[model samples]
Target: MKKIILLLTATLLSTGVFAQVKTPQPSPTSKIEQVIGLTDVTVSYSRPSMRERTVFGSLVPFGKLWRTGANENTKITFSDDVKINGSDLKKGTYAIFTKPTKENWEVIFYSDVNNWGTPQKWDDAKVALKTTAKVGTLPMKVETFTIMFSDFKMDSAKLNFIWESTEAMLDIEVPSKKIAEESIQKTLAGPTANDYYQAAVFYKETGKIDMAKEYIDKAVTMRKEPAFWYHRQQSLIYAEMGNKEKAIEAAKKSLELAEKAGNADYVKMNKDSLKEWGS
Candidate 1:
């Protein structure tokens, strides 16, 4: 009989421990995974769709840190080195945290990737990135923290991380075209640097003039490149800055580069630009 009672007590204790623990919630809506270089990061969570109560202080409250996602910490997994808003993040998992407000917010990439909601695991040293709040018009209250890309370029893109109140923007670049251009200028400049013209094309199209200039100079310096490639790129930058004279000169250079390089296609393009300007 004593054995039976002891067994019953043991069983009850085991049940109690489990009863106090909560189970992980089933999958909900919204999922996003980003490849920062080679590593894969996943974000899976849900959000309440238009709660009956007012969502402000009464529900989510203000001036309080909220788990940006529906359950646990909004998770960010890094597969490779990431530069989040100029701050470097080593590969790892991190708990994403956000400070909510009516019109602004503070986002946190906490080091402690594992934790429950509300009071989170915040290791100061582990913070990989933190971004200042940005004010923008969001048409709807996003249920979960979400990231989307826009303004694409060869080496970088704008990542818009959005939630209630406001959103933040970060430059996501892989193998960093900025660095790549500098590398080319430093090591690849010489005759036929035009071979590296693809890198310059991306920089110019993406509105990175300083970067484009550095690379284009290398290409032009290559075997006295027809002013074509060099002049053309300069024109693009001048147009961007609304400088007509520099743009005209650049057009002339493009024609020269093309004729010298024996690329008839480029010369025709520059000729058209000059004709349009009646020059």
Candidate 2:
């Protein structure tokens, strides 16, 4: 009896391990990433097949909020702020929900993205942006639900949702021109004061006293307000150039500014340099 019980327990354990089955999900998850202009957009959702059944009106009822996908909430992420149907949306991840109708679909970007399907408790305040997209009849039937970007442009694109023979499109606009212009302006504006200071320090370290003096002078003149570190670097450059008067003058200014800014390190450094230069 004991041997028979042990054999039965071993059989059951082996069966439990071997009986686990893996099969294709009825609705498979899909993810797509796109770059429109300077922004990166990503969509993650589950795809459900029609399986010869009617979609849209019947399977997915009209005048109701949909998860926009099968199992989990459909999520869309943006690398930069974007405009959808003339409404501004911040840069972040959002769950996409929708209400379908024969003429149009109300697409919603929801702030909360942790729900399994539609939220049990819908909060209007959680709705980031809601826009209506006109429904169009597709020439060919789409067996599986699809979400994709179309009509690509440098600053704009269309987010298309197609299922069966119905299609809906949302226009997305990115700040490509604004970003590009800002970048161009910054590049064309010439180096900053810190750039000159760093160049001066590099030149000084490389034993190029002339270039160091030129850069340090430019750095000092560019500042609208006095910076102790900049003046300190200037003093060092002048001292290296064998100009005791200018070095002492710059060290004195650095000492004053450092004292005002409550920087003990710079104050001590400037005082030591001043004493060394016979100030």
Candidate 3:
């Protein structure tokens, strides 16, 4: 009987099914993410509730380094290089620590991303970027700590930190103008067959007949199997260049290809142009 009881206890322990206890946390973790132009910014932190306790100068002292969050170190990540408080900050995750005062808040971005609460020993060498932001007071009391993005634009946004009745903001800027200009230049310089064909149509409509002919010829040469629309545009370009013979010939080819490809619209277009040209 003793051996059987011991065997049953061992089997129950091996299976490892046990009851779990649920408890509420005083401070809860949260993740906030936002896209400012082409840059991705993510913040991970813990939010401690007011619980009717004084925060700014009492529980969280003034003129001293604070964890900026509860439990683990508050962290901020940047997907691309960004400008913070008018200074360049490279792309990486950093621990956020702050010193609050009545006038302004001193924000520090530390290189050491992994730490608990506050650093055991503060290291000036690990500081990546440091900046100051003016503190503002909220009209109503806030129950929970929150970080938010506001006042967004094409290349910039404001990162706001709110706890209790105090709020602080940091300006973040991304390289939008330079990226957009480079992309436009690259796409314009590498025109595809469709691009050339479209340009030809535009130039032909705008009365640049010589430039229209150049683009249409280039489009035809670049296409392995020119579509019915390409041939129709080519015929229109030839007609605008005062070459009626070549215009009629190109229209006939367009009509044949359109009919074979089952494009009724292009077929009708080519037929109308051909008839007008006395083909």
Candidate 4:
């Protein structure tokens, strides 16, 4: 009797160890992190494949609140405040729920981020943002559930949900103009060495030779260890100013630095410029 009990315990332990072996999941998890303008957007969800079965109205019923993905609810996070479907949405992570219909889809962003399947006790108080997106028919059937961004601009894009033959879209907008203007103001107020160098390059291209020379001189002085590229810019500025002596001097300095750095491209560029300038 003692031997039998020991054998039974060993068999149960072996079965538990074998069960720990991993296998392919029916629905796989996916994560996406994307940056739009100055904002960071992240999405986490599970993708379920269609095994030659109808999805929209059959596998997933119409006019019912869906968790938006298999297992845990789909999550979307925003680093900054944004607009969804022209409605204000604060910055944070939210559980995305959906209600599909033939004409339009109701997209809900719920404050509750932890839940399994549908919220058993649905709470309207937990709702953060709710909007509607028009449903469209796709040309071809999609075998797996997909969420993607499209029609991207500097400040805005469209989030698309696709499954089977239906597509739902939501417009997302960020404050790109405010961020850009603030960045420009901050840069112009207290410019860095690289900023001065970029301004010099811009001025040189725009036929402002005097400003180019001034900014380049400031860049050379401000930098702790100026690179070969900076000397190359100085050489170009001097050459454009019709100062052949200074151009030759700057080109020689650039060639020496490039050779020390083992940068074959810059070496060739300096050699070509020196030959052109008779340095």
* Top model number, TM-score: 2
List ranges where model 1 is wrong by over 4 Å: 1-29, 36-39, 56-58, 119-122, 139-147, 161-168, 176-279
Q: Cα RMSD (Å) per model? A: 19.7, 5.5, 13.0, 13.4
lDDT of 2 by residue, 137-246 (tens): 99999999999999999999999999999999999999999999999998899887889999999999999999999999999999889899999999999998999999
Q: Work out candidate 2's RMSD over C-alphas.
A: 5.5
**Local lDDT at 143 for model 4:** 90
**CA shift of 244, model 3, Å:** 48
C-alpha positional error of residue 119 in candidate 3 after TM-score superposition, expressed in Å: 0.9
Model 3 CA lDDT for position 7: 100
TM-score, candidate number 4: 0.64
Ranking the candidates on TM-score from highest down gives 2, 4, 3, 1
Instruction: Kindly list the per-residue Cα lDDT of model 4 for residues 209-239, writing each as its tens digit.
Output: 9999999989988889968899899999999
Candidate 1 lDDT tens digits, 8-87: 99999999999899865442556677554343556655654333445546566777887775666667666656666666
User: Ranking by lDDT, best first?
Assistant: 2, 4, 3, 1
For model 2, the superposed segments whose C-alpha errors exceed 4 Å read 1-22, 194-279
Best by lDDT: 2
Cα deviation in Å at residue 120, candidate 2? Answer: 2.5
My TM-score estimates for the predictions, one after another, are: 0.46, 0.72, 0.63, 0.64
User: lDDT of model 1 at residue 191?
Assistant: 40
- C-alpha lDDT (0 to 100) for residue 165 of candidate 3: 94
